[model samples]
Target: MAQISNISKQLQLKCSGERFYELFKNKMDSITQMFPKKLLSYKIVEGNGFAHGSVVHWKYELRGTLEAKQKLHMDDTNKAITLEFIEGDLFKDFEMVAVKGEVSDGGSNGISSVKWSVEFVKANEGVAPPHNYLQFALESTKGIEAYLCNNN
Candidate 1:
């Protein structure tokens, strides 16, 4: 059987949960601008960007330059978005990979926090846990928060 593992990280933000959710929902076209050093391109190759049923093609540098195609599922009520990997470099070592990002109210402070999780089925147990990927999400979330607070 394939070995399955999950990892997650959280990032605090000055922006509201709604604003954080809006990044993926509406402002993803500006992804490269927000993280130019990490993300090379993010294009909606199929379906639509606003509602559900969309496929995004991402070309980015993690440990190295990698490309991925993913289908997006957005939950407005929960303020969460999921990206199910359809194809790309991720398949080289994993049998399955799904990434979920959730934005929530940060208690009394009224700040926001984004939680990112990666669930994966490894091709073999020899593969290390996806720490860098989770880190990437955290960094990206921070970038979004900074971009929104400073630019918008």
Candidate 2:
């Protein structure tokens, strides 16, 4: 098994915590919906969409024709949202996958920051981090951040 690897990034947004949270929630949903066929989409399979154990199912597109089921574990507490990739193509073939979000107090700056992180476990025991995985995460983050910033 590969060692657990972590990636973290923080971004400041010019919005209140409540406003920021609302936008962030919507943006997350929007991002999750960007799967192949739109058939494998995410819904509140349990409690409210913003609560723990709120399961989200989506399809991760592999190449052009391959796709696999991805089940997400949600934890919304302490102004943070945690998404654990409990079941997915990436997790099955690879090792582990998780994404987390936390909102920082704006303080006197009037700008709130969102701290995002992703942890990955490798498929092969000795290989380095894959370029494609990093690219995909970066692209996805940029896409959602751009959309949220532009629209909000």
Candidate 3:
């Protein structure tokens, strides 16, 4: 039996809530492009892009070639979007594994903080997933940070 584990990482970014959402919604492709090769291979497998119930196909090269379908299970009416994995490689199942781009704080100085996080669990015992999860996340943050920071 594979023991299930959860891993979550967060990042704080200086940007406004509304602008963050705008960048996230409008620039997802650009954001996706920033992801490492593993995440970049993942694609929405069902429904329309970014909507609830949408399924995304994710592939990681380091872990014996597995595909995980992430389903957008919830989008907060006010604050967040959550995706649950319905099927595919590495895990028996997973939920809200990759979370990013949410406003954590707002300020009067025309500045705000955005937090991004990713949480994932192994599906079974003995299956080592990719080692670059954090690296991938950080690179993504750096990419978005540079884009937003430079444009702002």
Best candidate per TM-score, number?
Answer: 1
Query: Pick by lDDT: which candidate is best?
Result: 1
User: What lDDT does the true structure give each of the candidates?
Assistant: 0.84, 0.57, 0.57
- Model 1 agreement with the true structure over 1-152: per-residue lDDT tens digits: 66568999888778877878887888777766778878888778899763467998999899899999989899988989998999999898888998999889777878788889999998777888778888888888777778888866
Provide the lowest-lDDT 10-residue window in model 3.
Answer: 93-102
Indicate the TM-score of model 3.
0.65
Model 1: which ten-residue window has the lowest total lDDT?
44-53
Better of 1 and 3 by TM-score: 1
**Between which residue pairs do clashes occur in model 2?**
none
Candidate 3, 42-110: lDDT as tens digits: 677688886667787877553456677767654444445555556765445442255434554455665
Off by over 4 Å in 2: 24-40, 43-50, 60-77, 126-152
Question: 127 in model 1: Cα distance from truth in Å?
Answer: 0.5
- Roughly what TM-score does model 1 have, to 2 decimal places? 0.90
Candidate RMSDs in Å, in order, are 1.7, 4.1, 4.2
